[model samples]
Target: MFRDEGYDNDTLEDEEEAIMSSAIPSKVDPLDFVYTNIPDTTHILKLDANCKHCKAKKIVSETDGFCCRNGQIELKQPEPIPELMRLWSSMDADSRHFRENIRFFNG
Candidate 1:
């Protein structure tokens, strides 16, 4: 038989307080240390021509292309893997490090 052990509201509140305290730092503005313009750094995509598969607009770069309507179509450049690997290998150590450490943040 299950016996009712009375629910402890005080204990529940204490646990919640403890969790909240640990979740946030009591420090100065954390936002001040972050680079605000980091999100604005982007690659400009050049539109190429109409898509061959769907006859929609084909926006492209040296590596790949995307169609306006045939977005699901894989438009990877011929021998993409080898080309990408070659590009990766050609980059300097610092450049490679920077690319590897790229992160996206949302507020």
Candidate 2:
């Protein structure tokens, strides 16, 4: 069951005031924070390739030419992602994490 109702104008205004008081100080100017064009921060992909299995929307091994996770298809490379990136990626979460290992990715 859901209560489909909205707060009155006064109640909403008081709630906003409370939130503003609890929040961090706001920027003095709209342009105080500067953003610049940057490269991809994290390329979090199970298998970053366009193999037959990947094209079919199925999770696959990152290495060994991006074949299906079934291990029936041929394997190309043992590891495509480097140690740093591999650790950052899910590394077959759909199969490993969902099936056997249970854990959450750290922020």
Candidate 3:
């Protein structure tokens, strides 16, 4: 059992490493390479409010989701509507009800 668990752990770690490596470009200076190869464009280190991805600019939120420079697709987070509905259904009437239901509230 212990040996089997160790083997499974090793497999998981290997898979994680493979995924992470694939996510990032293999170049020593990925940014430098991009700047040299690709056309002049804005450089973003992280996706935040100012970032186009977070602001849902350039790409439609309901459609394209996020944009990537190298044509690499950005995966969308799972929609919360269904999960919220499930939670609402499971909850009692009092617990589910909200006093002040604020809609379209953005930080």
Estimate the overall C-alpha local distance difference test score of candidate 1.
0.61
**Any idea how many clashes model 3 has?**
0
Which ranges in model 1 have alpha carbons more than 4 Å from their true place? 1-4, 34-107
TM-score of each: 0.25, 0.18, 0.23
Model 3 agreement with the true structure over 28-102: per-residue lDDT tens digits:
774775577665678655433433444444522333433454245566797778746664466565435531232
Best by lDDT: 1
Over 2-71, each residue of candidate 2 has an lDDT whose tens digit, in order, gives 3337757777778789999778566565554554445558776574445554344434554554355644
Task: Please give me the total number of clashing residue pairs in predicted model 1.
Answer: 0
TM-score-based ranking, best first? 1, 3, 2
User: Which stretches in model 3 have alpha-carbon errors above 4 Å?
Assistant: 1-7, 28-107
Report the lDDT of model 3 for residue 23. Answer: 91
- Model 2, residue 75: distance off in Å is 78
Q: What is the overall TM-score of model 3 with all chains considered together?
A: 0.23
Q: Which 10-residue window in model 3 sums to the lowest lDDT? A: 98-107
- Candidate 3: lDDT of 45? 50
Steric overlap count per candidate: 0, 2, 0
